[model samples]
Target: METGIVIGAGIMGTALARHFLKCGHRIALIDPDEAARAAAAAQIGPSEEFITAPTPEALPAAWGPCHFVIEAVPERLELKRQVLGALSRQFGPDTLIASNTSGLRAADLARDMTHPERFAIAHFFNPADLIPAVELVPAPATSPQTMDLWEALLTRSGKKVARLRADLPGFVANRLQHAMARECFHLLEAGVIDAEGLDTLTRYALGVRLALIGPILQRDLNGIDTHHAIARYLYPDLAANTTPAQVLDDKCAAGMLGRKTAQGFYTWDARQERRAQRVEALLPAVIALARQIETEENDDAEMGEQARGL
Candidate 1:
């Protein structure tokens, strides 16, 4: 069994560790904080295949080098550098040292490595275990051998990997996500769309279709002529500001930081857990239905071609 060592026992780290464990790998989860390790342990539970340690120093001295090492530290640049640097020191050149960073440039994290060509950014989405997508980003110096090894490993672990050639800001999903969010907030503040109205409209009207057909394909389905007309008229008026949204900033200043604070745009105190569970249960089925729709569309087109040939 390939050995997988994950540093930091935060939510993201713990989820990745659990994923590897489920994949039948020997997993070593290390975190400096005992409380964090304890929390992760409680969440993941005891397993003979899993090794838990408060710190790398606290691991059994006999522990050999691992096949894979991933640093799942905080988003702060310096902290990730320090943790990943230490991992590089522990493992040798053949081991692929990776960071579970969502938005950081691969160069920034790879800077601390002795062999920068071995460093990579494997960005897992929130609720890592449930999400199928992972952005596997390679630094400019990263080698083909490293990419090949990770591509095979992550695919075996059940990830729908998107190997990004360029490490652009926000990658793909996040860029489109934030862009749409920018417009959402703009409309909200202008009184064009209320919070609840916007949520319901997006979830039912746009979200359902997006799940069935991705944005570009959907554009083709609707005819690019229509897209051209909309873009010509609306592009200039869309939000282009790089600054933070005033409404969210004001809400944060007022201490309404969502579920943690029990309120933000909506009150989460009473409904948060129940709503989260519902969404979690519904997502898999949504993905399944999306796939079924795609298959049916393909089958119908094939039948049309057969009839025309006959």
Candidate 2:
């Protein structure tokens, strides 16, 4: 069992700790907040392989040298740099250092590190335990060994790894997400659709289609020529705002930050919260079905090719 240290005891960190423990790996969760540590322990339940410490200095001697460290602290470049620098000092050069940043560049984070080659990005989605997808991005200075190490580790741990060729802003997933979100918010501002209609449209249309086949593959099946034509017609009319949507800004300004605050575009009641939980709970099954379908399609194509040869 590999020994992993996860810094930050927030939702993503706690989920990652639990996931590692479930994979029969030893994990040390570090957070300065006593309350956050307590809450994480409670959420994960008692496990011999799992432990929590307020800092790396407090880690027990029995945990051994960390094989990997995932820094899941809040999204701030300077804070991440500080944490990573400290971790680099604490651990040897062999230990892989990864960030769970949603968008920050790995090269920028490794700028001040002693061993830039050992650092990379391993961005996990929320509810990291349930989310099967992980975007692995490496810094320009990051060694191929580091990328291979993380790819092997996460894949062995049952993650669907998307190794990005280059570290760009927001990586792959978030950029696609925000692009769609931009249009959604733009439609909202234009009074073309309400929040409910928007969710309904996305849930039934984009979500369902994209779940089975990725956008590129779906476009191929739909004829890329048609997609190109549509894009040409739609591009000019789409939202091209370089700043945050005014509606989103106004909502944040009013402290109506969605489910956490019980309001945003819509007021989230207990029932709505339960529905949201249900959706997340069902995501794994949906992803499984999508994979199964993809496999079957590939098999059918192979069989067809064999028949044609015969």
Candidate 3:
């Protein structure tokens, strides 16, 4: 098994480390806080043997010569540059460095690195252990051999890798999400629907439909002609703001942005926390259904090939 090092003890980073341990990979977790490290260790349980480095500076000396090093730090450009530069100096030329940046350009992130050729972005989704999709973005300087190796490793670890051609902000998924969110905000600003109603509409209608078939497949099933007609009519009224919709603007102005702020679309209190937990509990079943669909597709392809041979 390949050895890996994950920097940062944030939710996503800790989850990645836990998943790596589940896959039987040797892992070294680099985080500054003792409490955070203890929390992460508890999450992984006592059975798994993994090393923890107390600081970023200690990472290089403690976990050198790792096959893969994933920097799951915050989405700050300078901080990532500093970490990558240090890793490039410490690790071998062949060590693959992956940044878990959401929408940042891989090329820009790798620009100051001494060994940019081995650098790439492996943008894993929230709750990394549960979400199987990972965006594998390569910089222009990234080597083909390095890309191939990391792709294989991630695939073996049960991640669906989408190799992106362009290093656009928000990559692919978040860009789509932001676009939808913009429109949702615009509607709320116009008083078209209440927050609860809007959430219900999405959870029941859009969410269920998208869960069964993705955007492209849904478009294919609905017929592109109908979609084009709808798009032409609705496109003109859409909000073009970099920020979220007017309802969100009002909320921010009033200092309500959800659970964090205790106010936003919906009012948040202890009761809201319970509601959130109930909503989140539905995800595992949804993921299981998605996996079943994927397995059926694979089985169908295999049977078709066998029939052709016969």
Across 1-310, the per-residue lDDT of candidate 3 in tens digits comes to 7788899988888999988888889888888888888888888877544877786467556444588899998889999988888888877888889999988888889978888888989999878987888998888899888789889999999888998887788899989988888878777778899778998999898898787689999899999999999999988777888755566667779988677788767778889899888866877788889888989999999999999994
For residues 1-310, what per-residue lDDT tens digits would candidate 1 score against the true structure? 7888899899899999999898989888998788999989888999988888977777786666688888898889999887877777767888888888878888887777788788888888867877878888888889988988888899999887899999776778888999999999999989997999999999998998887779999898999999999999999999987987899899989999876688888888557768977998887787678678867989999999999995
Write the residue-wise lDDT of candidate 2 on 1-310 in tens digits.
9999999999899999998899889999999999999999999999888899999999878777889999999999999999998898888999999999999998888877888899999999888998889999999999999999999999999898999999898999999899999999999999998999999989898888887778888888999889989989989999999999999899989999988789878779988899988989898898788789868999999999999995
In the order shown, the candidates' Cα RMSDs to the true structure are 3.3, 2.4, 2.4
Q: After superposition, how far is residue 289 of candidate 1 from its true place, in Å?
A: 3.1
Candidate number achieving the greatest TM-score relative to the actual structure = 2
Kindly report which residue pairs in candidate 2 clash with one another: none
* Candidate 3 lDDT: 0.85
Q: 153, model 3: CA deviation in Å?
A: 1.0
Off by over 4 Å in 2: 294-310
TM-score of each: 0.91, 0.94, 0.90
Question: For model 1, what is the alpha-carbon lDDT of residue 49?
Answer: 81
User: lDDT of each structure?
Assistant: 0.86, 0.92, 0.85
Error of 1 at 306 (Å): 16
